[model samples]
Target: MSALRVNNLAISLDGFATGDGQSLEAPFGHAGERLHEWYVSTRFFHAQDGLPGGTLGVDNAFAEQHEQGFGAEIMGAGKFGPPNWQDDPDWKGWWGPNPPFHTPVFVVTHRPRPSIEMDGGTTYHFVDAAPSEVLEQARQAADGADVRLGGGPTVVREFLTAGLVDYMHVAQVPILLGRGVRLWDGLESLEDAFDIEVVSSPSGVTHLTFVAKPR
Candidate 1:
């Protein structure tokens, strides 16, 4: 079976994945671009923007993996847009006409909408379903390739709780936002289910990998 993986998920030392006050103006909320500073500094990010001149180092290595071996993606509605995005019929997503996914992307939301096909081969399909059911949908869409578990903290937490994730790569940034949406809430003692590996980078962001152990 194809694996369900999460790549380049950034979180703060305080365990917050995203900050408060999420809106169109503040996509990452009050957290802003702080959580993703490690990623945006990479050569991988520069290449994605069709630019040049970015650091090609340890951070770049992990950042590049985000686009590899994934045929489909499942993201939460929060990741798809700001709060109450369903209310805005005109809202497409944070990404413009050409999204980076380049695959069938499923948006798990309470309100399902008509699918939107973008310029790059990325198509957004909104579905009102549970994590397991959505994973199955993404798996089928992925065919023989792996499925990418794209996320907001809430969605990732649900999948982690459901044991639906096979592998996860989290970039632990050093900053701390005392108030925000945390990633580790209600997920106590989760290390037992997955073998964890921690690698620190010169950029002060520690890379943590979690791979599910065999049953």
Candidate 2:
């Protein structure tokens, strides 16, 4: 069976995963690049940006894992676009023509639309189904590989709430967003289900891995 995983999700010291007022103009919102400073300087990140070089450290090691095994992606409507994006017929998504996800992408949204096949191997299929339903579709699309739970906090929370997540890696940044979307909302005692290991990097961000224990 393919494992469901959340990779490289950054959170604030206060536990906010993403700031408020998400839009095309401010994808990371008021939090800006504060949460992603760690990975942004990694060689893995520079490679994604089509740059020549960047730091090769513990951060880079973790960053590389995000792209290693996943065969398909599942993300929230918020991660797809800003508010009212569904109304824009011309919106192709935040990643432009060639998205980083070079695989089938199942977008979780209330308003379904026709599938979009991007320049890369990415194909966006919008669905209004629950986590389990979408996972079923993505599992078939993954073709025996792992499934990535790409998120914008709200969506991650939903899947975590549904107990569908098998593994997760969260980078706890130093900054604190006083108010914003939180990943752990209503998920009390969630650690009870997983075995967590913490590793701090020289970049000042702490990496946390949550591996789901046998049920």
Candidate 3:
């Protein structure tokens, strides 16, 4: 069946999904880019952005799997672009012309904007609806395929806390940001059940996949 999956979400050693003070200069927060070192060095990311070349190994394999696993993607306002709201309606996104995600993308934002058409099949839909409502719309857009939760911490936390996420893949990096946006911030309790089905890639990056068991 269709599942709400979070694939290749990076987290720091300190459990921070994003560093503090997110802006255009620091997209993933101050030191958040460090968490995604594994991804940026992979051939999957290079090929996605039409780069020349990159390494091919376990990192590449994981990157490829993560990229291909999702039919549609959901991002929070913070992940899509700058945190501050703008009055202008023409701001497309951080991606200038083409974005990496060539599939339907639903962005959860308080401000409403018309759907953006990119060079590839990628289209960004700004939804002012609640998280559950947006997820339903994303499911429809996914066409029976898995929906990926791509985010800026808050979104993932929401889905997790709501018990909507079926599976999650976290790439734990070795670095630590003392103060930043944490991944497990809003979780009500540590007793919540999540079964770790797979854990591997201990060398370059630590990959862990967990399946949320029904309570």
Which number leads on TM-score?
1
Per-residue alpha-carbon lDDT of candidate 2 for residues 97-148, written as tens digits (9 for 90 to 100): 9999999999999988999999879999999998999999999999999999
Deviation from truth (RMSD, Å), model 3: 2.1
Which stretches of model 3 miss by more than 4 angstroms?
A: 50-53, 188-191, 197-204
Question: 1-215, model 3: which lDDT tens digit per residue?
Answer: 78888888888878888888887788877885688878888888888768978778776777787766577899988888877745556678888788877889998988878898897778999999877899999999999988989876889998887778888888888787888889887675633668875455645577877788876
- Find the 10 residues in a row with the least total lDDT in model 3: 196-205
Alpha carbon lDDT of residue 64, candidate 1? 90
Worst ten-residue run, lDDT, model 2?
20-29
Error of 3 at 28 (Å): 1.9
| Candidate 1 per-residue C-alpha lDDT over 114-148 given as tens digits, one digit per residue, 9 for 90 to 100 | 99999989999999998999999999999989999
Task: Predict model 3's lDDT versus the native.
Answer: 0.81
- After superposition on all CA atoms, what RMSD does each candidate show versus the true structure? 0.8, 1.0, 2.1
lDDT of 1 at 136: 91
Question: How do the candidates rank by TM-score, highest first?
Answer: 1, 2, 3
Off by over 4 Å in 2: none
- Give each model a TM-score: 0.98, 0.97, 0.89
